[model samples]
Target chain A: MSLCLPYPTLMLVTDRHRSSMSLRDAVRAAVSAGVDLVQLREPDLDDAEIERIARDLIGTIGPRRLVLNGRPGLAARLGLGVHLRDGQRNADVAARGDDRLLGRSIHEAGAVVPDDPPDYVQAGNVFATRTHPDRPGRGLDWLARVVENSPVPVLAIGGIDASNVAGVLRSGCHGIGVIDAILAAADPTVATVTLRQALDRAVRDQQVADTGNHTGILGRGTMI
Target chain B: MTASPWAEDPACLRAALALYLVADPEQSVSGDLVADVAAALAGGVTCVQLRAKRLTDLDAYRLAIELAGLCRQYRVPLLVNDRLDVALAVGADGIHAGVTDLPIEVIQRLGNGRLLIGWSPESDGQISAAAADGAHYLGLGPIFGTATKVDAGEAIGLDGFADRVCHTTLPTVGIGGITSRTAASVVAAGADGVAVVGAILRSSDPRQAAWDLRAVVDAARGVRAG
Candidate 1:
C-alpha cells in the first residue's frame, strides 16, 4: 500500500519542557486550533511512557495526525508516522510496509540526500531559539538551498514562531514544524490559530495572485 | 515511483510562481537581502528568487541557505537565478534560468524532475520550446524596460506581452521594469503574474513596496474578472 502523508502546512512539535499545561491538554488545544500535524518529541521518556503519551495524543487527535519522534518501532506498532533523527535506523520497522509517513531531520543542505530518502525532510535551527541556544539560526538562505535540492518536501523546524513564520513560508518549504510556538504559548490554541492563519493567508494570497482576479471576497481582504 | 504530491496539483504549482520576487542584496536599501525578503513576504509576496551576480559562490550559498529557512516558514517558493549548484546546495524550490544559463531540459533532468524550473524566453519559439521542455513556468520579457538587469534586452510592451501570453499555456510572469503602477497592465495582458527586482528591492520600504504592488495586482485582477 502507498503511504499517503497528510499535507499539513502548520505542524506543532511538542516540548513538554516548555509547555505550561500537560502535554495532553496542550496537544488537545493545539489540534483544536488547526495544528494538523503533531510530533511527540520527548527524549527523556522511556519506551513505555512514550507509548502511553502517543496513545493519549492519538485519543485526543486522530491516529493519522500524530507522529512519534525517534521511535519507529513504537510508531509502527501504534500505526502512526515516525520522525527519525539523523543516525537512527528504521530498517526493521520500515520493512513492515504498513505505509507510515516517515520523516528525517536534516541540519545542512547535503544531508537532504540519503541512501534511504524519507517521505519528508525536517530541517533547521533555522532561527535562534531557546531550545538550542548553542546552535545559531542557520537562517533562511540555508533552508532555501535545502528545499530546492530535496526530492521530497522539506519542513522548516527549529526556532520558528509567529514573527518569522511569514519569512519561512516565502522560502519555499512544504510546511513548518514548531515546538515552542505552540507548546510554550500562554494559550496554545490561540497560538496555533495565529500560525495557521499566517500559513493560510500566505497560501490564499498566492492563489489570489495566481488567478489574477481579486474581485472575489478575498480580494477585498474582508474574508481572511 | 509515486508521482510527487505537488505535481498533481495545478493550483499549487501556479501559487508557487505567483508574485515572484527577484531580490538583490546589493540593491536593497537595507543591504540585507534576508531582512528585505522577510519584509516582502510579510507584505504578501508569494515567491522569491535570490539574484546575486557579484557574490562569490560561497557567499551566495550561505545567503541562499538562510533565505531558504525564512521562505519555508511562510510556505513560499524560493528560486535562485543562474545558480543551479547553489539552488541544489540550498535545496531551493528551483532555479530561474536566463538565456545564457543551462538549458531548461538539462536542468530538469539534473534536478531529477523534482525542481521547479522557470525560464526566461524572448520570442514565441523560445516560449513554446521552454513550455514543451517541461519548464514549470516562463518568465517573459522586460515588459516596460528598465536598468535592473543590464542585459534585459528590449521592452516587450503590452501588445508583445499579450502576444506571448497567447502563444503558450505555461504560466507566464512578466519581468523587468514592473512596479505597482504598471503591474496591472501585465495581468491585463494575460500573464499569470509579475516578477520584479528594482521596484521593491530599491524602494525605501520593501515591505510597503511589496504590499502596494500586491494591492495593485489584486485590483487589476479584479478589474479583469469584472
Candidate 2:
C-alpha cells in the first residue's frame, strides 16, 4: 500500500500583498481553523522583509509546517522546510526528507515527473486563476493525468477555492494548496473551515458510497 | 525504469489496466518466464507484471531485462512486482508494490518518479489514500482467494470488493483467484479489470488462457459502457 497521508492536507501559500489582514494573523487564524502548512512565498520582498514575516509565522505556524519559498540557506538554518521554484536548482539538494517537507511548483500542464520528485508537488492553475490571470489554467483532464502519473502526492494550486474543491478532490489529488481562497477571504478563518469541510465531506461521502446502492464512477470518468 | 510515456498517459493507463497479467514465477507451469509473459502479451494482455518472490536480485534483474525487451517489442508496459531495484536497473516500464513491499509513497518520495506505480491496498481506509498518494492504479483483492499467495488473506467477495471500489476514484484491478468464470463479475464489481496469476500461467496454452479471460473482461466493460 502507499503511504497514507495523515489527513487531506490544506496548505496556505502566504502572499502578504494578497492577504486581507497581517500575514501573521492570517496564517494563525487559518492554522487554528485547520490549515496544515503555511508557505511563506513573497518573492518581491527582499531577504530581510521575507525573513521578518517568516519569523512571525514560525511562532504561529511552527517551523515544522512553515515553508519558505526559495532561500534554501535560511530554511536550513531555521529548521524549516523549503519550496523551490521551477529551475531554481536541483530539487534533491533542498528535498532532505526526514521531517522537512519539500514542495515543487508545476506551472506547465504536462512537464514529465522529474527524476527526483519532491515530498509534495503543488501543481497547476487548474482553472484560469487569479494568480496567473494571463496563463490559461490547464483544465481538469491534465490535472488528472498528473495526479495519476505522479509518484508523490500532489496538492493542486491556482484558482482553487471552496466552490469547486469537490471537483478538485474528485481528481484524486492529495488536497488543495491555495492563496486567495483563505488569505483574501472576507473571513479567513471561516473560509479555511469551509474548504476543510468540503474536503472532509467529500471523503466521507465517497466512503459512504461504498455502503450505498450505486458505486459507478462520476462525470466523464473524472473519478477514475 | 525506462519511462514508458504511454503508461504515464491517463488514457493509456486505463487501457493497460484492462487486461493485467500478473506473471508469478512460482505459478508459471513452464519454467521459461519470458515465454509465458510473451505468450500472454501476444494474447492481448495489455500489461505484464513479473512477480518473482524467490529469485535472487541478479537473476530477477536479468530476467526482467529479457521481459522488458519482450514487452517493448509488443509495445506493452512491463512491471516488476515488489522489486524496485530490478525494475529500475532493467528499465522496466513500471513497478507494483504490495502491502508487504516498500510502500509506494516512500518509493515515490525517494526519487522513483520515472515509473508507473501500482499499489495493492489492504483496506477501505487506504483506498482514497492510495489515490492521494499518487498510485497510478490499485491492485485490490484476493477477490476470490487462491493458493498462489498463501498470505493473500480472505477473498473479499464481489460485494466486499465493490464496497472497497466505491471508496476511491483510482483505476483498480481485482486480483486473486480470478478466472474466465469469474472475471466478468469482478469487473462488474467495479474493478477496472481483474488480475489473474494461476488462471493463465498454469494453463498449458497461456496465450489462449489470456485470450479467453480478456474476452470476458472486455465484454463485461462493454456492457457497462452500453
Candidate 3:
C-alpha cells in the first residue's frame, strides 16, 4: 500500500487527563506551534465518543494529520487514519480500501514484517515515562536497532522531551511522538514551541554531526 | 504562517557538509591521530573523517572505537573512510565511499538510509547518477590536483568544478589539494564546502590551519549570500 504518511517529526499523543485544557484546544494550540501529527489515544471513550472527537480534530487537523488509535473503521468512516497496536487486525481494515494512513506500534526489534508493513512504526518508550514508570525505558541502542531492522520509518515515543531529543535523533528514528512534554507543560503551546525548536535544533545538529561537523564544541565555546 | 522549506526540516538528508577534515594519521604532526583531530576541531573543522589506509582491520576497528568516542564527546560525527564494517562497528554517523568501494545503492540498502553516504564522483554523469541513487552528498574533485590520494583522478579545475556543481541538488564538497589560499575559490565555484587532508594534517598547527580555512569558507559563503 502506497500510503503517504504525515511528516511526523514531532507528534502529540492526547491524554485529556494529563492536561488542563480540552483535547481539541490543546491539539489546536500545539498544531499551531509546530506539532505536526496528533494521535487521539483516549482508550476509555466508546466508538461514538471517538467519532465525535475525531470529527472535531479532523476540522482542526485536516487531512492525514489525525490518527485514531485502535479504531480502523471509525478512522475510515471519518476519512482519517488508524494507528494499530501490535497484534491488532488490519487485513480486514486493509480490505475496506479507503485510502488513509496506516501506522503500527512495536516495542522490540525485528517485529515489523515485510509482508504486512505499516507506513510507519511508532517505537518506544525510549526513556522511562511517569505514565509507564514500571516499564524501563528502552535506551537509544534498542531504538537504533529497531530503526535498522524496520522497513518503514520509526517514530520514537515515550519519555522524549527537549533534553533528550537530540540523542533520539542521533539514534536514527524518523521523528518523535510526545506525551507529557506538551500536555503536562504549564503552557502547552509554549511547550510545543520549545519542543519543536529543540527538535529543529536537534535535527540541524544531527545533520551537522552527520556531515562530520564537530558537535560538542560549536556554540558552547568548548572547542579544544 | 508560510509552509517551511523542505531544506529546513531536520529529517531531510541535507547536511552542512562544510569544512570537512579528512583525518590521515600519517600526516599528523604529533603522530597522534585523535589529538590532531581534537586540535582541528578546536580550530573549527566542522567534520572529522578517519582515513586509515594502512591500518589492519583489527587496528582500524580499535582506532575507530577511540575516535568515535572522541567525536561523540565533541558532538561531531565520526565517519570511517571506505570501511562500512568499521563504520557499523563503531556506530559512526556515516561512511565516505570511493568509486571502488561498495556501490552507493548497496550501502543505502544495508544502512537502511540511516547512515549518511558520501560519494566521490568524477564526472557529470557520475554525479547525476549518484544523486539519483540517493547519495546524501557528493564529494567532487581533485579540484586543483594533489599528492594526498595518489589515484585521485585528474584535477577538475575551478571552471570544470563549477560546471559539475551546477548539475545536482545534493550538497557537494570539493576535495583534493584544497588549501586556505585556494579554499575560497573552491567555495566560490559552488561547492557547499571544501574537504581537506594535507592542508590541515601537514600544518605545524592543525588548529590554526583549520581556522584559516574556515575563515576562507565563511567569507566565500558570505559572498555567495551577498
Candidate 4:
C-alpha cells in the first residue's frame, strides 16, 4: 500500500520537454504507458492554467502519482504532493503536514540523506542527462551507496532510461528518475511501458535473488 | 523486496506540511482543485486536511468521503479540521484541533492511534504540554502574521521557532502565514516540518509553489550535522 517499496525505481518523466503534447495530454499518454510516476515541471504557466492541466491529468492518473515540481501551493490546494528541485530554498513547511508523498533532489549521496528526512531521497545523473548540465554524473557506485545508506527510500536520478534502468537497479538502486527517456521520445507511452517492464523485471530478479524464488517461477509458470 | 514500509520510509513524516483543502458546498470546489490534489500527491505531499468552515456537516461529510477517496488513491492521509464526527463519518486520517476545540486527551482517545492527532501550540509551554499529552505533532505558528487566521498571534521568527522547538519532544511544524520565502529559516530553526495556506492555494502555480517550499525544507534539513 505504501509506495515506499524497497526497490522502487521511479521514472521522473517530466512534461517540460514535449512540445507537441500539452502537459495534460502528455500525462494522459504517460499514464497509459504506465509510467510509475509523473512530475509536472512546467513553470512558465500561470496557476489557473496549471490547475486546469493538473485537474485534467489527475482525472486519468487514478492511483498513479503526479508530482508538481516546485509548486507546493497548487499541490496544497489540490491536496497533492510535490517534488523540490535541487538547490532551491523556501521556508514554507506547512505543506509538509499533508500525508502526501514528499520528495527532494540530492546532488550527491550526501545531499540525498537528511537528518530530518523526507519520504524519499533522489540522487542523480547516474548517467549524463540533458536536463541538467551544472551537475556532473554521479554514476552507479554513488547510487549504490545512496541506496545502502539513505534514511529514506533512495531513487536514482538524472540520465536514466529504459536501456540502463536494469543496470541501475542491479547496482542497488530502488528507483529510477528519468528525463529524456520518456520526454524526448516520439512515443512516451511506449517508453514508459518499456521502462516499467524493465524495472519490474529487475525488481523480480532482485527479489528472486534474495528469496531464491526461481523454483516458484519454474513450478507455477513458464519463464517469462 | 518486502522491506517494512516504515523501515524504508523516512523517519520523519513524509509530508510534514499540512495541505489545507478549503471546501465549499455552496460553490463546489473545482475539478481543478481536486486534480491539484492529485498533482500534489504526485509531487509527494503526505497529508490533506479539509477546512470546510462554511459547509454544513452533512455536506462536508460527503465531500470528505470523496476527497478521502482521492487521497486514498494517492496513498496520502486525509484529515478534517475540528470535525470529529465528519472525520469519523468519512473515515478520514484524523482531525487537527485548535486550542478552543476538543482537548488533546479526548482526541487521542477518540483516535485510538489510528488517526494522527495534531495540536496547535501557540507557545513553548503549549508545545511541551502537547508533547506530554502524546500529541502526534505540534502546529507551531503564526510563524508570521497573515490574514488567514483572524487575531493570529505575533510572528515567531525562526529564532523563536528554534527556542520553542528545542523544548518539545514531539514532531513540530511551523505554521501560520508560512510561505516558500520563509520555509528554509523555519527548518533551519530546528522545526521538524512547515505548514502553509495561501502560499500554494493562492498561487498562480500551486504545484510549483509547493515545490519551491519543499526545496527550501530540503535545503534547511541539510544544515544538520551528520
Q: lDDT of each prediction vs. the true structure?
A: 0.76, 0.75, 0.75, 0.63
The backbone clash count of each candidate, in order, is 42, 0, 6, 69
All DockQ scores: 0.03, 0.01, 0.02, 0.03
Return whichever of 1 and 3 wins on TM-score: 1
Q: What is the CA-based DockQ of model 2? A: 0.01
C-alpha TM-score for every candidate:
0.54, 0.49, 0.50, 0.49
Instruction: Name the best candidate (by TM-score).
Output: 1
- Cα distance off (Å), candidate 4, residue B23: 7.6
Angstrom error of the Cα, residue B48, model 3: value is 1.5
Assess the local accuracy of residue B36 in candidate 4 as a C-alpha lDDT between 0 and 100.
58
> How do the residues B11-120 of candidate 2 rate in per-residue lDDT, one tens digit apiece?
55765677788888888899777898877865657678988889999888888888887666444678989888898788787789877788777767653577788998
Give the per-residue lDDT of model 4 (tens digit) for A165-202: 66678767657777777777787778778887777777
**Model 4 spans with C-alpha error above 4 angstroms:** A1-224, B1-10, B14-32, B223-226
Order by lDDT, highest first: 1, 3, 2, 4
lDDT of 4: 0.63
Colliding pairs, model 3: A212-B47, A213-B46, A215-B75, A215-B76, A216-B74, A216-B75
Report residue B219 deviation for candidate 4 (angstroms).
1.7
lDDT (tens digit, per residue) of candidate 3 on B89-177: 87887888978899988887776666777888766788888868767778888888887788888888999889998888887889989
**Candidate 1, B1-226: lDDT as tens digits:** 3323223444555544446789887778788888889888766576789999989999999999999987766556678898999988988878888778998878888778888787887778888787778777888888887877787788889898899888888878888799898898888899767889888889899887877886677566552100
Candidate 3 CAPRI classification by DockQ: incorrect
Reference contacts preserved by each model? 0.02, 0.00, 0.00, 0.00
Task: Arrange candidates, best TM-score first.
Answer: 1, 3, 2, 4
lDDT of 1 at A157: 83
